[model samples]
Structures are given as C-alpha cells and as structure tokens.
Target: MGVVTSIIHKKINEEENTILFFGRILEYKGIDYLIKAEPLISEKIPNIKIIIAGSGDFSKYESMINHKNHFEIINEYIPDEKVSELFQKSSVVVLPYIEASQTGIIPIAYAFKKPVVATDVGSLSEVIVDGVTGFIVPPRDSKLLADSLLNILLNKNLKNSMGSAAYEFMKENMSWKGIAQKTIGEYQKLLGNFEKPRYLIGSLQ
Candidate 1:
C-alpha cells in the first residue's frame, strides 16, 4: 500500500532534547525495555527527556524504570494535531518492538525528518538503514538500544543529517506518487499497454 503523502513537514524543535515513543503501549511493543534503557541513556545525556506518548497500563513497569524523572508518560490516545506536535518536539523516535510485522511509525517519523531508533525484528530492518536513516538494535537489548538512542541524541549534526536522509528516503521510495506509478505500471503490463509504459519510463528518466 502507498503511504499517505499529504503531510506538511514541521520545523524541528531544536530547543528540546527529547526522545519519543509515540504509539500503543503493549508488551510486544517493548516499551518496558525502552523504559529500562532510559536511565542508561540519561547517564550520558543528562538533560535529555523521553516522551512516552500512548494509552496503556504503564503501572506494570512504573517501578522498574531507573530514571522515572526523565520521562513524561502521556497515557492516553494522542489526537491528530498532537501527533505532529510530538514528532516535531522530539530529536529521535524509538520503536522498541519485540515483535512486529510492519509499522506505520517509521514513515510518519520520516515525514517529520525525525531519525528512528528501532529494534531489529520483522520488517523493521527493511525500513531502517543502520547509521543512515536511523539505528537498529537487537530486540530487548536495553543497553544497545540506549546506546543507539544516545548516539543520535547526543550528536546534533548526526541527528539532523539522519533526519534529512529519512525524509529523502520517504520521498524517493515510499511516497504515494511513486507507489501509484508502480501500480500503474503493473496495470499497464496486464493490459499490454506497451507504448504507455515506455512513455512513463521515459518521462521518469
């Protein structure tokens, strides 16, 4: 399916040194591991804030996180307008999924040019380019996850560069326009519209 291409990019909130986890809070989502990593990450980047924006039973791991003070848990459904706000405010977006088939968060983060720190599981590896658009760590490894997030948050230049690359990747490969063209190509092939396919390829060139 083609990604929704109607988003308008917002300027990054440069003043806030924030990391975000914006989605459902579930066991498979691995928010517990992310929370565990917060303290380790905070040790290196003391002032960095972690925003866990979603609705779920956060009390399950509330006592386990070492650096609870550094986190802001918005334990409710995030509204449409607020989605952009959260993405814009954060320096990095994290997906610490223990298991997943696919995720819509990466493309959404790409729209804001926000670099991601996701676990390597299922299709997440296909979406994230390690050391390029973002970093992918092994699932449930809080230390490695923290290190990857720290690497992005501590270095502003790297964050900005990766974010820019993320956006470019979205525009080039995942944009609805590109997806529509591919769909059209398939349809044309089925219909034996050879001349139109040539025209399409030529125009792209």
Candidate 2:
C-alpha cells in the first residue's frame, strides 16, 4: 500500500487546500481533541478546513467543534478507492489517536507524501520523526496539537520538506516489497534445518 501511494503522489503536482483526519470515529481516535483544537487553528488560518472522514455518533462531538467557519464532516466510512482523493485534497493528515499499535493509516499518509501531526503515543512517534516528517505532540494536549497544526499550515516550506522526507522514508523502508523480503528471510532462517518427528500421532501393536 505504501509503495502504491508513493507512486501516485509522484505523478500529481498541486497545492493542498485542506487537512484530513481518517479513522474510526470512536472516542479514542481523539476526534474530541481535534474538535477542541480546530478553533485555535482556525483563528490563524481561516481558509484551512478540517475534513473528518469516518462515521460515528458525532452529536456530542459536533457541539465541541467550532462549526462557525472552517470544518467539514464526512460522517461515513470512506471507501478504499476514495482514500487517495481525500489524501490528495488535504494539506496534512492528522492521527490524534489516544491509544494505538502500528497504524496502517500512517503508512497511507506517508505514501501520499502528506505531512502528519500525530500524538506521541503508541508506535506513532516511531513512524513520524518530530520536525522532520511532522510534529508529535503529547497525547490529550489540544493546545500542542493546535499549535503543531497551525505551524505546518502556516509554513509551506516546512510542510513540503516534511512531506518529501516522509515520502522518501516510506519508499526505502515501508513498502510491501521491503516487508515481504525481510519476512521471507526471517522465515528461511527459522526453517533452515530439517528434522523428522520421532513420535507418531497413533500407534498400533
């Protein structure tokens, strides 16, 4: 997937017009955090839009977000094909998850060469280098998230540099070809020696 995204991004050349958040709409995905951060971000960059791509019971969450200006909610499960469209349209991708393992979403963002702003929890920091690929704010810190988002939006050069670095990193390390080759090597090392089982499942005398 990462390999595919990298190739697609290289073919397109256009400026971004929005920011996108992709994932489940559960409480832990930190939609609430983003909602709170939006107002602060909008104050500085009014034209910047935050596009929420995923569905959940957003009634409570909606109230928290400042819907007065720059926000759009696509409260539905985004299909795989349309994900690229979302990525292409957005300036940056944010993964403000409270808890996570290795996220597939991060790779997708990298593949698209879109800079990310993620909370420093789980394996997110491992993937995103602060000030290189994107900024990693402490989890649950809406102020930091807002600040980081604002910084990336306001500075076009920083955004482009980070996006370029992310794309290069993904191409070299995170591709399916790279993963499969490494996995095969590991399996071969483990299965190098041949042995016959001495015991039988059933014996008859």
Candidate 3:
C-alpha cells in the first residue's frame, strides 16, 4: 500500500493535482459520505478530482456522484502490483472509514508523505493527529469531510507541511524495523520475568 501511495504521489506531483483517495469499495468505507460531499466541495474548487480505486457494490452511491463528474471511479479490485500505479496517479489519500481499529491504509499514506483526511473513529485519531499529520472529523459528517478535503486541496503549504510531518512520524515511529525491535524487547522482558516451577522431591521419594 505504501508503495502504491508513493507512485500516486509522484505522478500527481507531476500533474500538480492536490488530493486523492485509495482503498477497498466497502459500504463502511464511507464512499457515500464522500459522494454526498462532492457537490459541496465542487462549489468551492470546481476542478477538484477524486480518484477512487478498488471494487465493491457502489450502485447505491453511483447516483449520488453522477452529477459530480470531477470524480474518477476505478470500480475493480486493484491488484497488489497495480496499487502503486494507482497511488502514483493521485494526490492525497483519503480514508473516511466509519469504523476501524488501526488501519493498514494509514501507513501507506504516511509512506508516500501524503496528507490524510480521515474520520475520528477508533484508532484513526491515534494514527492521524488533527491539524498535524492530517485532519480528523466526526464520523458520518460529509460537511466536515468536505471542508477538510477542501482545506488540504486549496492550501499547498499546509498540504506539504502535513505531508512532511506525516512522513517524519512514520520514519520515527511506524517503520517495520522499529516495530520489530520493540516487539522483540517486550518478548525478552516477558521471558526474563517468567518463573520456573519447583519439583516436590520429598513426595516423589
């Protein structure tokens, strides 16, 4: 996922676009919310383009986005290799999940140093610090989501600043190497504190 975001970031940078979103096409993902907010966002930035990748049942939300032609919907299960291709083709990666326990997708956005606009649900807030790495809004609020998205898209300085901060955060904390070392240290401590059982030699004799 990180690799994909990096690719998308590179490409979008070349095109000078502002934002993007990548992930599965699940109902819980809040595509409906994004679709609903499209017109509101477009009222501000008419050129704003939202690229949605990954396949799922979007028939219900299709009508919602029909009038707003600024969105590009890739309605197919993007393969692992193709993920980077998609990511490289866009700007910011949005994750508006209604429920989550720590998302693997967040790390990918961090990897590309792409600023995020995720809902303040579950562990998402823990991952994305509002106004720092990215903005976090109340879940199911399309207006707030649209506002955040517009803010990032319109403000290049803020977008770059947040992206840099996000990248630094990932480098300092979320890397696989750092996680492995921390996990190993915890295991070692647990093993060192483990007690050994004593045998009842007198009873056996």
Which candidate's lDDT is highest? 1
Badly placed stretches (over 4 Å) of model 2 are 1-17, 181-205
Candidate 2: clashing pairs of residues: none
Minimal lDDT window, size 10, model 1: 1-10
**Candidate numbers sorted by lDDT from highest down:** 1, 2, 3
**Clash count list over all predictions:** 0, 0, 7
Residue 71 lDDT in candidate 2: 79
lDDT of each: 0.85, 0.81, 0.76
TM-score of each: 0.84, 0.81, 0.81
Where in model 1 is the C-alpha error above 4 Å? 1-12, 184-205
Best by TM-score: 1
TM-score of 1: 0.84
What RMSD, rounded to one decimal, does every model reach?
Answer: 6.4, 5.8, 4.5
- Sorted on TM-score, highest at the top, how do the candidates line up? 1, 2, 3
